[model samples]
Target: MWRRRAPLATACAAGEASLFVNGIDPGYSGDTAVYGALSLVTRADSILVQEVCDYGNYDDFDFTGTSMGFGLTRDDEPPPLFLPGVIISMFGGLVRNIAGHVGVELDEMRQRIEPWYTDERIECAMATIEPGQLAAVRFAAVGVCGGVPVITVEHVTRLTAAAAPHWPYPPDGHIGVHRVVVEGEPRVEVNTHVSHPVFDPTDAGCISTAARAVNTIDWVCRAPSGLFAVADIPPTELIRGVMW
Candidate 1:
């Protein structure tokens, strides 16, 4: 069957830039298309646009529900945004040209998300309780798109407490927070937003101090796992995958 390749090409062109399909039909049976697609990486900052980006009929083996794995290619390291699905609405949005940049509008592009985790309001799911000798805290995770709330993570738990050795004074330091629980153990939940991209090294020191103060509170506890892995809303430099 001579399947349609225009749909795939269209989807690719609607994004950050346009992709030349080299006049190949995606329906052609075999892995040749896959190789041809992979070979496009030599170009500068290009992605391997999957013509039929959806999961195959094999439902059990198909990871389409949680991760599309669309085979995005970049010249540098990839973006840190963990996208589990494709943005269906993006196909209908207005396409903009940001100077030399192509694809969708800047504001509209920010709205695209694949959902790494569900959204749960930390205000409701989490609480800090200082019980005399010990301190207990809980946090909630929410999936956000373009600054808007979408899903909530009510089941998972992730918590981090600022550590000692005091990060550093200038721009040459990295601070780590403790999880308050043993590795591979169930834990309490905690929710808090992190302000990343400190821009200046001096400012980073102040933030690190603030983090340490939070952890020093008697006994601050948190969830052992979940979305609280890398803090929250990190800078583009700190992120590795395609951020919604």
Candidate 2:
């Protein structure tokens, strides 16, 4: 069910970059979905210095790519019956057919726009960030419904830290004593989770290229609900889990 297609890239004079991608969910009746996205922010003024170092350079941009498509559900075959069973089967088949058509059109659009963005242009568009500042990147997804496309979702993540609170006990009545204590900044971890309509781990070439482009910050693509566990698990358990 996988298609041999490359990501479609585009940039605007206003310093915006874009990438359109297509992936198929083989497990779900080979249903294909398209993900059209704006380019990730990469300027030194937009990303944290520590995060930039994590990627080895200020240009190493991390992004949460998203896509949207119909939530196709696979229906179970029903017993052979009269009009009721026939109607159910027909409706299910019709829905799948419509989804398939949308997928094809999306793929065609991606292919048509491929030439607009070249390798050199894409590299030049990725900006860099400075140290100690929080990253200023944003994430959004394009969705198609009834043959029309629209912006369906948007997200943003921020990194922050606060001083640890202190507690003191009162002096005993027998002895007069006073004590005060101050604590350093409390360490906090920031996590950004993004969900896409479809993902294919087998796309080694695409994944490798993206990882390198972002300077390899351990990007993960998992099931829609899998991200919830990231907050509960330790760093060692933050393993990559993909749902196709």
Candidate 3:
């Protein structure tokens, strides 16, 4: 079996080089992607980054069914990711990073949860849904600046692609995408559609997250020894160190 341990070795004391990586979310979307969108507009109102995907294609029954509570009913409490303090602890840094970039002092961080329940039973790659079970969920982490929600990170996860009809989605209605939407004059929406020839949308998300670390390795190695935010270093001009 493939095995791994945390990469604890670093050149901090020597201070010759560094390695920094953030596995997805506020790091990739908030720190890096949103900044690109903000660069396009002079006047900004609010910013949103969303990962919209149908987990049914992920093919991991245990993860989606138990860990994510995808097939859970109202009687069951929400997953740990949605529990109090989880989103904040996980995403608060991204919010603060964006706030710092935008020159706003955050008043507070807020959380919002919306669940979509299904009336009929359904089967998918991840879990078998029962009547009254959750078909989709929307979770948002908001950064309030000057009494306004200036920055937001949202997840729109569904058992099937059609679960959350009213929520934001990719223009092509694909299964997996990272969407960055800046609400401003000359507003821009950047949708990064993720796919793999071998894996489905869910597995492709896992692959894409892992790729962030690989793709940015060169840029990170040459920097001063420290942790990194997405804005700290720009990526190379093109893909590198991979064989076709």
In order, candidate lDDTs are 0.23, 0.21, 0.74
For all predicted structures, in order, the TM-scores are: 0.14, 0.17, 0.85
Which tens-of-lDDT digit does each residue in 126-146 have in candidate 1? 222121211111222233335
Better of 2 and 3 by lDDT: 3
Worst 10 residues of 1 by lDDT: 21-30
Which of the numbered candidates is closest to the native, going by highest TM-score? 3
Candidate 3 CA-lDDT value: 0.74
* RMSD (CA, Å), each prediction: 23.6, 24.7, 4.9
Error of 3 at 231 (Å): 2.2
Writing each residue's lDDT as its tens digit, candidate 3 over 59-137 gives 7766555655677788887787668877777676677777788887888999888888888877887777888888888
Encode model 2's per-residue lDDT on 111-171: one tens digit a residue.
Answer: 0000011112111112322232222222222233445432122222221111001211112
The all-Cα superposition gives candidate 2 an RMSD in Å to the true structure of: 24.7
